[model samples]
Target: MNFKDYIRVIPDFPKPGIRFKDITTLLKNGPAYQAAIEAMKQQVAELEIDVIAGPEARGFVIGAPLALALGVGFVPIRKSGKLPGETVEADYDLEYGKDKLAVHKDAIAPGQKVLIADDLLATGGTIETTVKLIQKLGGEVVGAAFLIELSYLQGRSKLGSVPVRSLVTF
Candidate 1:
């Protein structure tokens, strides 16, 4: 399936001179959504992933299904105060703004291999920070997966040597 067909492009969304690639359209289509997960799953097939970690909101939407497909646990990296119990937090800047993310201190155990998932990769700040959160809790970040990646933004560079897989790039 052509994943891009299901993605809607909105001009100047949430601000001017920004084209937002909305995944809600693709997510609403069952076949398209499944196909996307399959593609991402294929990409991560070679990685030794113990669990899938994703930042709050969109990450939850994408990571949960992927985790189910991989028969592994899903760890949610939420906003600063979204999770209960001990948590590790990271503050970062985005393409359009700045934000923070947090994950439960026990979300993953020491030496656990984690694969981060998300709807989009723009500035890479969120994913990078998420990796920090995972590592702080003793989890090892093996790789990252995304549905859409704005390559021109050079998000991958921010990810260092960590492997990053994306279904579509623009």
Candidate 2:
């Protein structure tokens, strides 16, 4: 399937001089949704992940189903104060401001392999910070996955040596 066609291109979304690839169009189409998960699943087939951790919002949309497809648990790395009970948090700098993410104290057991998933990988700061939180909780980050990756931004460099997989790039 040409997943690219399912993604709508919106000019200057959330800002000027930026083209946002909107996934909502794909989400509304069942075939595109399944194709995306299958493609991502194939990319991470060799990772041997024990759990899939996705950031809040868009992450939940993709991560949950991917986790289910992979037959693994899904852990949510949410915005600060979103998770209940004891949580570990990491602060990261965005292009315009700083933001924090938190995960449950027991999101991952020590040594358990985790794959971080998100809708897009731009600067990689958000996902890298997610890995930090996973590490803080003693989880081994085996890899990271994404639906779309903006290659021009060089986000993969921020991810260090961990394996990073993506279904499509723009």
Candidate 3:
């Protein structure tokens, strides 16, 4: 399927000179949403994924369903203090400053294989920080998946050896 057809692109969104790719259009369409997740599932079908991890908000939308499709558990990587109990945190540089993400200290077991999923891969800061949190807990990152990727941002470069798959790119 032509996934881009289901996405809405708004120019100068959130800032001037920026075009935001919105997946809410596709997400609202049952067929398109299912197809997108199925397509992403196929992309990582060969990976040894014990669990799927995604950042808060949009990432949860993609990752949870993907995990269900793959028959694996889903873990949420949230902003600091969003999670209860003990947690592991990683700080990453934002465009203007630094922000932190945390996962419950016991969310990922040592040596478990994990696949990171999100709605987009832009500058890679979130995913990079997610990788750190997983590694800090001794979880092996097997691959990363996305619904859309801003290739010009070169976010994948920051992931090092972790493989990546995206259903759509802009």
Candidate 4:
């Protein structure tokens, strides 16, 4: 299935001159949602991921299901103070300002392989920080996956050598 066909392109969303690829439409469609998950699963099946780490909000939507499909634990990388107990944080730059992302201190065991998941890959700021948080807790990032990628933003550049997999591009 061409999942991208289900995505809605909204012009000037949250800002001017930005064409936002909204996934809400796709999420509401049963077949499209399944196709997306299946596509992502195929990409990471060979990675041997020990856990799936998803960024705040949207990432949780896709990442949780992906983790379940892979039979792995799901770790959430969220904004500061969102998680219980001890946590580690990584600060990063955004197009507008700066922000920090944190993960449970013991969420990822040392030397375990982690696969980062998100709904979209924009500028890679959040993903980069998430990767840093995982490494800080001693988890190796096996691969980073996204449901959609805005290729023009060049988000992958910030990710360096980490393997990146996206189901759809625009």
Candidate 5:
């Protein structure tokens, strides 16, 4: 299926001159949502991942099912205070300052291979921090996958050598 056809483009979303690719429409459609997750699963099927880690909110929507499909576990990478018990955090730069992301302190075992998945790849700041959090716990980031990527933002540049794949690009 052409997954892009399921996405809704919202003009000037959250700010002027921004065309937001909303996935809610796609999520509402059963076949398209499954198609997206299946597409992502196929992309990373070759990567031997011990765990699937994804940042909060949208990432949960995509990662959970993908993890189940792969017969692996899904780790939640959330904002500070969202996760109970001991947690580790990595800070990322924002337009003005920075924000932090937290993952369970023991979310990944040392040397475990991790695959990061999300609904969209935007500025890459979050994904970069996510990669750091995984590394801090000694997990190797095998790949980062997304359902959509706003390539014009040049987010991929911030990811350095980490392999990134997106099913839909705009």
Candidate 6:
């Protein structure tokens, strides 16, 4: 399937000189969304993943279903304080400043295999921080998956050896 056909690109969104590749168009279409998840599942099918962890908001949209499709548990990695109880947090640099993400301290049992999922990979800071949180809890990050990736930004390089897969790139 030509996944790109399902996405909508908005020029100068959120700021000038930026073109946002929006997946809501594809997400609203049941068949397209299903196909995207199925394709992502296939991309990581060979991995021995025990759980899928994703950041809040958009990450939930991709990770939850991908976990269901892969028949694995899903873990939500959220902004600091969004999760109650004990949590592990990692700080990352944003365009302007730093932000933190957290996960329930017990979300992943020690040594459990994990795959990070998100809507997009832009600068890689978010996923990199997620990787830290997972590792801090002793989860081994097996792979990272995305619905879209901005290749020009070179976000994948920040992930080191962690394999990354995206349904579409712009």
The better-scoring model by TM-score among 1 and 6 is 6
Off by over 4 Å in 3: none
Give stretches of model 1 more than 4 Å off.
94-98
TM-score for each predicted model, relative to the true structure: 0.96, 0.97, 0.98, 0.97, 0.97, 0.98
In angstroms, give how far residue 67 of model 6 lies from its true place. Answer: 0.3
Clashing pairs in 1: none
lDDT of 1 by residue, 143-166 (tens): 999999999999899889899999
Clashing pairs in 3: none
lDDT of 6 by residue, 105-130 (tens): 99999999999999999999999999
After best superposition, candidate 3 residue 80: deviation in angstroms?
A: 0.6
List candidate 2 segments past 4 Å from native.
Answer: none
Q: Which 10 consecutive positions of candidate 6 have the poorest summed lDDT?
A: 81-90
Which portions of model 6 miss their true places by more than 4 Å? Answer: none
lDDT of 6: 0.95
Give per-residue CA lDDT, model 2, range 31-144, as digits (tens). 889999999999999888999999988999999999999999999999998877899899999777999999999889999999999899998888989989999999999998
For 33-115, candidate 5 gives per-residue lDDT tens digits of 98889989999989998999999889999999999989999999999889997999988888889788999988899999999
Q: Which ten residues in a row have the lowest lDDT in candidate 3?
A: 90-99
| C-alpha lDDT (0 to 100) for residue 53 of candidate 5 | 96
User: Which lDDT values do the candidates have, in the order given?
Assistant: 0.92, 0.92, 0.96, 0.92, 0.92, 0.95
> Could you give candidate 3's per-residue lDDT for residues 1-170 as a string of tens digits?
99999999999997999999989999999999999999999999999999999998899999999999999999999999999889989898988998899999999999999999999999998999999999999999999999999999999999999999999999
User: What is the total number of backbone clashes in candidate 6?
Assistant: 0
Predictions: Cα RMSD each: 1.3, 0.8, 0.6, 0.9, 0.9, 0.7
After superposition, which runs of candidate 5 have C-alpha atoms over 4 Å from their true positions?
none
Q: With candidate 2 superimposed using the best TM-score fit, by how many Å does residue 48's alpha carbon deviate from the native?
A: 1.0
